[model samples]
Target: MESSLSFSLPETLVLPLKTQLISSGSVPRSPSKLPFHHNVSLTVSLTVGTPPQNVSMVIDTGSELSWLHCNKTATYPSAFDPTRSTSYGPIPCSSPTCTNRTQDFTIPASCDSNDFCHATLSYADASSSEGNLASDTFNMGSFDSLDMVFGCMHSVFSSNTDEDSKNTGLMGMNRGSLSFVSQMGFPKFSYCISGTDFSGLLLLGESNFTWMLPLNYTPLIQISTPLPYFDRVAYTVQLEGIKVSDKLLPIPKSVFEPDHTGAGQTMVDSGTQFTFLLGPAYTALRTEFLNQTTGVLRVLEDSNFVFQGAMDLCYRVPITQRVLPRLPTVSLVFRGAEMTVSYERVLYRVPGEERGNDSVHCLSFGNSDLLGVEAYVIGHHHQQNVWMEFDLENSRIGLAQVRCDLAGKRFGVAH
Candidate 1:
């Protein structure tokens, strides 16, 4: 039973819904040699097609669809002509939302010879993409721009992604129905994650701010349910226990319960940067965070040098400490609310963006059982600097620890 539909606007044209903050632009990927920002990315600034073409996208809540990498003559970097959009459209195959998401998406038809509707999106770092499927006019940054239904991608399902490793595409904020917060009527959407600074803030609907606190809510848990009708759009949560120095890690809240065939599920994924646990909650949180930072923490090694890959609890410091030393008290509980987190927000570096200015602030948390199973994937370094609000018509998921207003102060849209 795959379905889709949601379109209703006329609250006097979009009433009181004015809080735009989409400002994101941080890209530091070097992947190894370990100054390890691991790929701190989050770009957004689109104005695609017809008299608009301003592309810079990559704000993906693990994607649902949104795309635009049209190839233009082929240098691939931000190309989007879509036939010079005059409101572009192209979706044929008798559009039943393109044969119901390509017959329940295992998406393998690539639709050509003129039936339109084609797609391929894959990534777990393998990186992929394939094109065709349009509908234009997506501006959404400086106050407004609409008429969505994206993906005009010219193709690159993978050949090791060249052309500067592509990506002038993807905006999908999942929980599908052709996402973008289900076509811009945001039943709830929020973002605030300053991995120190790429300058972030993405709230779109909800919050009138007459505040006295009130913002700690929880309940998202989907875990790609039994994985099929096109992989169930995961956002999962329900962790319930993990407080270090505040003590509480006998982990086994049924190992974070998630077994509809997706292994003890866990996914908060802001396009996964680092933070994965499951293998009994990453061996009881890497053996209780290395038993509370062995040797009282400090591992930016130069003298004793130790750089184990896939982050477990790295600490090494001193090439002139690049910040991050104030551990003990890690919190993640979430049933009623608990975020604590801070070892420089679990070790993320933006302090002078590190270009081999290496020292090591690792401890961004990992161990998805080394990708063999027992899943968990939090990422965005467990959402550094907090503040997320995905409400989706009250499906539940709110958080706090404010201070994100790139220029468009938000608060007013929580109904």
Candidate 2:
């Protein structure tokens, strides 16, 4: 069945955003504490089909392949129909495009009666999808790309249904050949996240403006030697230290480092909502934070030594509209640069429906005790008001503190 949702496609096409960001509905809460499975990932609006059916999807840099969660049953707000598009075709299971689950630890796929690629993706958050892989036309604005391959999911499962309402699928932006970024061949891309608006700008390809702006460069580290499963899977940056205000917190760099046997280094995830620090790293951060703002911030009652304990460092503030003095600008000190986390971005406003009051906010940073001391994740929330550029070609990333204007976007398609 064709969807009847009315939305206008952008009139501009050439420099169509291979990496764009938008927002959706959902209440983000701790998975164990509440049923809300909200994410702060940047969502992109996809224009699919001949007439162009618009669908929202999450921009997951950690994932390798892009897939649309299909359900004719209205389980997903939008889905791609290969049968309807003349440009659509399936990849045979024998093709290199079709990978085995055990071979490279890639997405799990099986051959159907027609020998088409059928795959399943299971995430750490209990979100999963089982589907058939196919190729078709992918359009954004006026720009059109032919024979792009993606997944048409048969069934999708997530811990939160509200998240499904926000996005129909995943737009994997990893270094894998199947990812949207690789398919587009835009090695250099940049984005700026808004701390206040929760909206941002995405610019793909080379630009002269890159040199004009003051940018701090850091080497993008990868897994020592990569297999298909480990190659350019995530943006890993070496974090040297974390500073609260003018004082640098006394936490060892080893506390933030990840085992090379694992994903390697600290990760920069645009899809994850909250920043996660390991046990020792978190303890030092929390203790220092509380010690500095002792009387300024009041810890919530019925909570453990560190505010609400493991899950968060919540506080009861008398905030209605103005910024509170209790909130500090947390900085993530990287190898080549330091990123100042905005006070607004560091704290989350507890929804009024839960506590029946709007005065409570919790730190977006969380303890990763449950996941073990694996790696530190600098999530989307912590990157607010910062312009982060991913230079895949050079294996480096540039960061700067500034809000970018989205007007007068340049458009061009590389042949």
RMSD of each: 20.6, 8.5
Whole-model lDDT values for every prediction: 0.59, 0.64
User: For candidate 1, lDDT tens digit of each residue in 42-71?
Assistant: 545546666886665556676678777788
Per-residue lDDT, model 2, residue 354, is 27
Error of 1 at 350 (Å): 11
lDDT of 2 at 343: 69
Q: Which regions of candidate 1 deviate over 4 angstroms?
A: 1-41, 44-47, 59-61, 67-85, 90-94, 102-134, 137-260, 263-274, 290-295, 298-363, 366-375, 378-415
TM-score, one value per model: 0.32, 0.82
Residue 291 lDDT (model 1): 76
> Per model, how many backbone clashes are there?
14, 4
Candidate 2 per-residue C-alpha lDDT over 205-242 given as tens digits, one digit per residue, 9 for 90 to 100: 55436434678899987665653323346788888998
